[model samples]
Target: MATLVAGANAALTAENPGLDHVVVGMGWDTIPSNGPQAELVPFALMCDASGEAVSNDHLVFFNQLVSADASMTFVGDGDQEQIDVQLGLVPAEVTKIIFLAYVDPEFRGQGTFASVRSAHIRVATAENRELVRFNLGTDHLDSVTAMIFGELYRHRDDWKFRALGQGYSTGLAGVAKDFGIAL
Candidate 1:
């Protein structure tokens, strides 16, 4: 069973201490709408110790699935997305990896997170043993277009996961800006 984390900033270590690879999975159901089709896209932003993206290569999404070092790669599609991270391969300068769920532009133009149902993010070992999970639908907000679900950061020489549960009304652009991405 996975450990359930209740709030933001809650930290949990991966299931197997010896594991070097972990998967961050996010899933959501699209609520029926009269407008364009609803799609939830998951992405990751790799940041340095200053919480700023090291480069454009650090932003992994549908178009750019893998990071520069191949430490992180986005997997799956549609309502579900998974990110595979090779902790040992991540660069020493990279200090944090943030996972996010965004309402695709077509869908965001018509609705917000309120149109997403049963949204959740989970972290697990390479073998599929879940370590921690956070449900992003607990407090759905119509004004928000994206969610900063959680983050994996370097703690001493080890990595730790933190449930952020933060919402952004400015869409992906806002998130990109916050992480030092030019566009």
Candidate 2:
């Protein structure tokens, strides 16, 4: 992976001195597939500092994952209960993010299910500065546990998610706290 670098305004060329643009490439491959398009399990995003969604965190999440066909992708917002295309405000200084790929609830029993093999994050500032690039790969069960725990942090505060899985919630909450993003 490339090191995170600052963005430059495209309009601000040697002659223009105004236009700016920043481009980042996030890539991944499923284990043993060696294919270009890897299937990513639905991963959650949260604030590494506060362990909660303030405002800017939402912005960053949308900016990174939002798309027209969002409903069909890993973070698909295709279902109304999930999300559609919508913009929200981002917060001031975001430090870190986490990712996880897992077997969907319906496909959990099947061995052949999509998992988040790898994740990459890139932040482009107003002038298109690439401020952050982070990647994670799941190679063992411990990593999988941590990823699930991260998701627990994301949904812990919600009343609707309260009854999803009592045992898993408790365990995941503890894991999230341990990772510095408690709920």
Candidate 3:
């Protein structure tokens, strides 16, 4: 079962005019189960309207955005860090963001199973604060562990949202398959 943290809340509009699509920024560390450090894995963005994954199969990158391996690489400590991505009307019109995450089976030995202690979704704004935040519970992400859902409205639009529009949810990756929102 999955949870809908926020319905379709408009975050932008024709008047405000947000970019039609977005490329997600992602970075993570790969650590030995018992080692004290972690390494970063590279990441890529997929703009497929059908929700097809963006892997080495479709696009390639020689440097920043692209690499030889299918997944993006992050070289550093295992701790989580934020990465930047470009957003625009390309590949396809992306109104939502999807995060595909799984517990590193090896991580259990180290105590962190690639679990997202917390997660949120927001528009690109003057301040980095999120327009909305979604929480996650065990039930929301049983196998994957957690999922988050965020609605990207046309920029500068007034959307109706509950006070706690943010709640526990399985990240967008989980919901897209069923609801077709991320697509």
Q: Candidate 1: which pairs clash? A: none
Model 1 lDDT, residue 3, Cα: 48
Best of the candidates, lDDT? 1
Whole-model Cα lDDT of every candidate shown, in order = 0.79, 0.30, 0.32
Worst ten in a row by lDDT for model 1 = 6-15
lDDT of 1 at 152: 88
**How many Å off is the CA of 45 in candidate 3?**
4.0
* RMSD of each candidate relative to the true structure: 2.4, 12.3, 8.8
Best candidate per TM-score, number?
1
Candidate 3 segments whose C-alpha is farther than 4 A from its true place: 1-4, 13-15, 18-44, 57-80, 92-97, 109-117, 126-129, 138-142, 145-183
Clashes of 1: 0
Relative to the unseen true structure, what is the C-alpha lDDT of residue 64 in candidate 2, on a scale of 0 to 100?
A: 48
How does residue 179 of candidate 1 score in lDDT?
89
Poorly placed runs, candidate 2 (over 4 Å): 1-26, 32-39, 44-50, 54-88, 91-103, 108-119, 124-132, 135-183
Whole-model lDDT, candidate 1?
Answer: 0.79
lDDT of 3 by residue, 1-183 (tens): 112254544333332345332222222333344542212122223424455443323222224443223232322222232322333422333323333332322433322223333443333222333333334332332234223333332222332222122322343334334434332
